[model samples]
Target chain A: MSFLSFLLGEKKTSASVAKDRLQLILINERRGSSAGPDFLPQLQQELVAVISKYVKINPDDIKVNLERQDSLEVLEVKIEMPQPEASA
Target chain B: MSFLSFLLGEKKTSASVAKDRLQLILINERRGSSAGPDFLPQLQQELVAVISKYVKINPDDIKVNLERQDSLEVLEVKIEMPQPEASA
Candidate 1:
């Protein structure tokens, strides 16, 4: 399945490209808003503190971003859990 | 700055809540699309292969999601570089 997928180059579908582009634009728009990049570091720390209380995580593993589409704004957070230290 | 920001509890502003809710909705909407959850593992592998060629990263560190808002669809990709092995 992987090999066929690679050879066919069907991986990059139009829908996929459009989705990426739209997300990127929204992400940038949100970042450029009044909150700005400065808000992220502090936000990240707060989120990490809150989330870590429930699940062990390195503060660095937490990522937060903003997305605005139409009248709606979205805050996206992604955390990559570190192995070995997963117990912490 | 961090202490004051924390004590005030202003971190979870209205904008932040709206953003998080919208993003969560979009992410779920995109994931629930025709592509489905099965598509993610393969997509993740493909992305890891392509991105690793340029910058060293673990496949596990990469995260991707889809968001659809009104008429627009967005694809979000987030990658976390592992430390200690950062040289790779």
Candidate 2:
């Protein structure tokens, strides 16, 4: 009966599995610890590369920050776009 | 010569077009103005609904916030997940 109960109770749903994955990803992203690599710098570099294809921009013109506030996980992406040409 | 120059200068590259679209979307998302709908609440609701499938959670347990810090646009999603059962 105990073995049967363990078998029945141990079954995990797909939703639970997804929850576990999301938790792991979010924790890794938030902590930027030894558990996993930090992805923000790569994200910033990619953003710069993509945006640079259209307009000439300095690498410093883009900023990416990941912050935690209370229970919230915030990902901020800032790109200082070039101003349009001034009309005469 | 003037008309030819205008024709040449007026052509927009796909990259520039993509930049324009991204700018518009970001602007709309950041401002939550009349130009476009705010997606944060819907995103929160959807997140709650999805997570609720695996774990029982209150609607207030999740918070979503979009904030602008200088040129940066921040999207924060916070979920207070339920604690696991204490091991015997």
Candidate 3:
């Protein structure tokens, strides 16, 4: 399931707000966790490198982040793949 | 971290297409599997029941979908949480 889907509720709710809310939650959930020892950036970078073989990516937006909740350890990779350019 | 985040890239891309792309990719990624057969819907409903404790949800939109990749099994969920109406 996607984050937007998580926040997206009801036919009345706009997808715009859903996008914003999901981003906030996902970021906070992921960032709030790196309180412990982690080599997450390295791992993220490597994952991006490996996955890039199958997709075109924008390096800067490829976020290698982690989230920590109680005893749970979650590693999240946000890959910003390039959009196809509009053809004139 | 999230599907939208995965498709969101560069300074020029629109969030509109990002939302759509993420939805397709996630649905396809999750639903593309489960070819053999699994009790996914039942699992989804129960999962939603458990998670809804902390969230407001629209039961109908809580899709219990699945996707299967080679040697990889993924259960994807789409939860449509309630949105606060306008203050008007």
Candidate 4:
């Protein structure tokens, strides 16, 4: 808020507070790329393998993408799972 | 955690949950740049103006930096503030 409060040693220094805020924004920008961390492919495989146990799903049915929304870095994963066969 | 729970209609779709996580990471990355948003200059000026009211501070005394640590984006602002004159 105000530096005067900081001068009185109320809580944390103004610099500390500013640093926290600035770093938060920087991290968001870095994660916004659609081609995110190298482990994404592995993550997808693991997800598909786990999800396949419950429903019939093709690997292509799963789609994962990274997006940026103002202060938010969003990961979107979509899956098209087929209905299980009707029990006789 | 598990997609089977999602199929049971517990709360949200797996896609929605994934989206939130993805976006968060992206936002952090975006904000991690040392040469951050264009508004930084204005922000520095405003901060200095506000802080100067209480103590003698030079613009250079304030340093703003953005750094990334794993999933955390840190904004560091260091300011050197002079002590105020003691009142009798």
lDDT by residue (tens digit), candidate 1, B55-84: 455656556665444433334465544334
Among these predictions, the greatest lDDT belongs to 3
Q: Where does candidate 1 chain B have its weakest 10-residue lDDT segment?
A: B20-29
Error of 3 at B37 (Å): 24
Worst 10 residues of 1 chain A by lDDT: A20-29
* TM agreement with the true structure for every prediction: 0.26, 0.28, 0.33, 0.24
lDDT of 3 by residue, B23-74 (tens): 1112112211223334334544543454454344566655544654442334
Candidate 4 lDDT (Cα, whole model)?
0.35
Which is the winner by TM-score between candidate 1 and candidate 4? 1
* Number of the predicted model whose TM-score against the real structure is largest: 3
Q: What residue pairs are clashing in model 1? A: A19-B75, A73-B19, A74-B19, A75-B19, A75-B20
Report candidate 3's fraction of native contacts: 0.01
Tens digit of lDDT per residue, candidate 2, span B1-88? 2222221233455432221100001221112112223343454344345434433455655555555443223344544443333434
Clash count, candidate 1: 5
| Cα deviation of B30, candidate 3, in Å | 13
Assign candidate 3 its CAPRI class. incorrect
